[model samples]
Target: MLSRNQWLAVVLIGLLVVSQLPGPMVHSVSSRPAHLLSTLLTPLSQWMLSAGNRATRRPDLLQRREPGEDAVRQLRAAREEIRRLQRRIEEYERIRHRFGEQLEAFDYVHAAVTRWSGDPANPWLEINRGRRHGVAEGDVVVNYRDLVGRVVDVGPGTATVRLITHPQSRLEVRVQPDTADEPARHHLVMVDAVPRRGRFEAMVEVDADAPIEQGDIAFLHVGEHRAGRGWPEHAYGFDVGMVTRIEPDQERLPLLRKRIVIEPFRDLPRLSNVTVFVRREYERPDDN
Candidate 1:
């Protein structure tokens, strides 16, 4: 309703009033309240943000840790499995080696021992191989170490092995010189016939002047006939019993004789298994 001139005058008055206001007063009015409000709310705002992040991040961290733990457990299991497989492989190899050795003896028909005779009066062993396995009487039995005895009887599936330590068992052995000065002497030495006190002993007669001493090694020579067919001239080496005592006899036969006592090898008492060597042919003294 006002005239145009009156409207223009009113606008000019409003502008003058705005222009007269202080610059500091204007700035304070606009910025002070906003800054104060922000300062008052800062702690609460930060707390809320932290709580939200924890709520979300906790589950994520837990999930990641779970995977790590699972990986560690799986790795341990794999290592254990590998170790078990290696042990099994080694065991198989041992069994295979033993089988191969047995097969070599099988070409000639032989059996493995199961148990030894428990009787002290007649020490013997029961073998899985018998007459059916070509085991026969007088077939000399030997272990991996030394001569065990000979097969005296055979049954359908079993055979009895007379141990070398038996009362009636006897082995003819030759004495070999261990030193350069000593000559190889051939004599028939007896075993298993000496008294129990001497059961583990060996007696040898040497020249009175022979430099024979105690603790010398006595080698047992298996006659080619006693050893199995194709068996080597000397099947085994054993420490003849230790020389415990020595007796010098000057009045004995053509040569002065010295009696040397020896202890038998420890393999005697633990004889459970032995190999039977079948002698194929006899060799003359010159052939040896």
Candidate 2:
């Protein structure tokens, strides 16, 4: 424990020693502590920078996934729209064809079958077109393949057609013999009625000398007279039925009455729709 004057002298000597030190030595010593602190904090600073970069990019990744999901949904919707457009195109094509047929003086009317008679023997079809659509009794109904039937009854917007195979229906046909000399000279054969069974038979009358045979093609004539001497006049070819067999009846005199098995041109059982053709001309007895 020195006196007050001795302590003051020691403090002054310590200050003078520090003030006389070289500037380079002081700077080097001072920088050493800062360098040590910087090395220690380097890894923590780098870790914080890496974590912030990941946090910033997370929102962009989520946005990318959302766009990918939306693209998938849009692709599916586009496929369905293409299918709907294709169906509409098909319907338009069908209507266009129907219009062309009507404009060509074919006298055609398109009608969809709404109902069918339950009885297989006496078959009939109810059509969507009726008197309101120019559909009347005796209007011939046909399809792209062949004739179907004739309208029998009419309502405001609906009509019923008697099928070709119905018992009451009789199609006057010209039997073109397989060995005929000329197709124009072939006379008329009455397709009387449809048999209940046994190969779907029908009736026809022919002169005993007339060339008639099985497997002949029977063609239906709409407005033709059969008893003429020359070629058929005022006739329209509508149907083709195959003759399965022909059996002559001996009891019938000079004219041979034969039972002929016939099949229809169009399968009436599968008919869905048909076109009705209105006959524009009338036939006289002496037309042929």
Candidate 3:
């Protein structure tokens, strides 16, 4: 009788003897076993080689790609910076076009408003420019042709501004005819601040036939009265306010007078920046 180990060894010896035999019979017997062994071992060897290559090169690939990502981030930041600068340039160009002949007469300084006072009726602003930056008391502050205020107090690098809404502020203005062809008329009037209202009112003494109405625009007049009023000559034609309401002046008789309530073209509390018209050094009388 044969044991299990003895039987396995006798079977392997018989297969080897058959593989070495001559003729087509031996190849036919060996072909299937040889094909099965080749199929299994070939894929295993290839998978191990591919995995080892990936493990060796992964860190190098990440290191090589880091600088490219950083450059992309830096490019985005630079584009944003360029856009900001272009906006500022376009703004200054628009201002120059609007106030062309006027801006040529004096040097101007741009200042940033740093603080807004709580009182709207007597609103004031603190700016980031002062005496050292050529800002001075009485210098007119404006956003284009819209009147802002005057510098009241100045330090080495800071200054305070009083807005036109203040109760003490007054300006002489002319309300333009709504239409150009409506026969040119001088609608001259004096605008005064309305206490606690943060606005101005002009009372006109006119006959019942006066042509004043709502929607008319008022502009600061440039005349002999402006010379000593701490206002620059270039600020003469700046916009002051617009006629918002028209009603009868009951205190003076409806037939003889009317009240024209004016509202500023720009809201004071929203001011963020202003241009100060600084006196030219060469034209200063004291310098001569």
Candidate 4:
């Protein structure tokens, strides 16, 4: 029932469709060997994977470097210790310089206390340095600050000291008021030690209405004792201690006198190290 030309067109279209549907889904390249391509590409992929792994592990490797890690830590610690020691040395040098400045006219001999007299009222000390080290019988013994005592006896390598707390000790001292509200005034007082209860106290008499109060400082008025035969030479402005309390003079005149109790700056019982100050010798007028 169809025309010859229409039937021929339909048959041609079916042939085109059948040609497209029958071929393989993949294309093969003919320029290279297929087996060789897989072999070469496999190694390249392995190399890329290994490179990625190494990149991720770089931070950990950097931390784990050679065995010098412990050494570096120890080196830093040692440097810090050295700096600390240097600071301590510098402090010690500063103290030494200050001591040198304080002891200008007299040379110093360092010593350690060998024993204490066990008597606060008549306190004395025995030291390990003696006449061989220029520590004479009358040399002044001092702590870092001020006078502690005077050397009484000297052996070849040992010496004895009579402290300011001794009952026989006598010193000319000046009392000063530290408060700014008070007038700038200092009063001369003769001080001596006495045993009270369990401790030794230096007592001095001042005016009943003197402005001397607690916290007032006391200094040795050295020029007053220069004319005496048995007195030790001392520089002016040597600090003795502070006035701790003011009591009524019970033995002398309680109504007319006020007793000043001074606490010495030097701690007698704790004295382990001291420096001896040697006074310069001068020929007496009688000797000349």
Candidate achieving the largest TM-score: 3
Give candidate 2's error at residue 157 in angstroms.
2.7
Candidate with top lDDT is: 3
Q: What is the C-alpha lDDT of each candidate?
A: 0.50, 0.57, 0.65, 0.63
Give the count of colliding residue pairs in each prediction.
Answer: 9, 0, 0, 0
In Å, residue 69's CA in model 4 sits off its true spot by 44
TM-score per candidate, in order? 0.43, 0.49, 0.59, 0.57
Choose 1 or 3, whichever is better by TM-score.
3
For residues 1-288, what per-residue lDDT tens digits would candidate 4 score against the true structure?
A: 879998999999977875666333211231124223333444454345445434542232113322464988767656655663464355346545645454455677888666666676667876677656667767788876556878876665667788777777777777765433344566878777675542446788888977788867676664434554255544344556678789999998998899988876545544667788864333212322
lDDT of 3 at 205: 48
Q: Quick one: how many clashes does candidate 4 have?
A: 0
Q: Judged by TM-score relative to the true structure, which candidate is superior, 1 or 4?
A: 4
Candidate 3 per-residue lDDT, tens place, 16-109, comes to: 9886789568756554454344334434533543354345422321133234547776676456445534643553465566666667767889
- TM-score for candidate 1, residues paired by index: 0.43
Colliding pairs, model 2: none
Candidate 1, position 89, lDDT: 48
* Residue 60, candidate 4: alpha-carbon lDDT: 22
Q: Tell me the lDDT of model 2 at 165.
A: 72
Which of the two, 1 or 3, has more lDDT? Answer: 3
Query: Candidate 1 at 110: error in angstroms?
Result: 6.4
Estimate candidate 3's alpha-carbon lDDT, on a 0 to 1 scale.
Answer: 0.65
Q: What C-alpha lDDT, on a 0 to 100 scale, does residue 134 get in candidate 2?
A: 68
Off by over 4 Å in 3: 1-103, 199-208, 224-230, 285-288
Q: What's the C-alpha lDDT at position 270 in model 2? A: 46
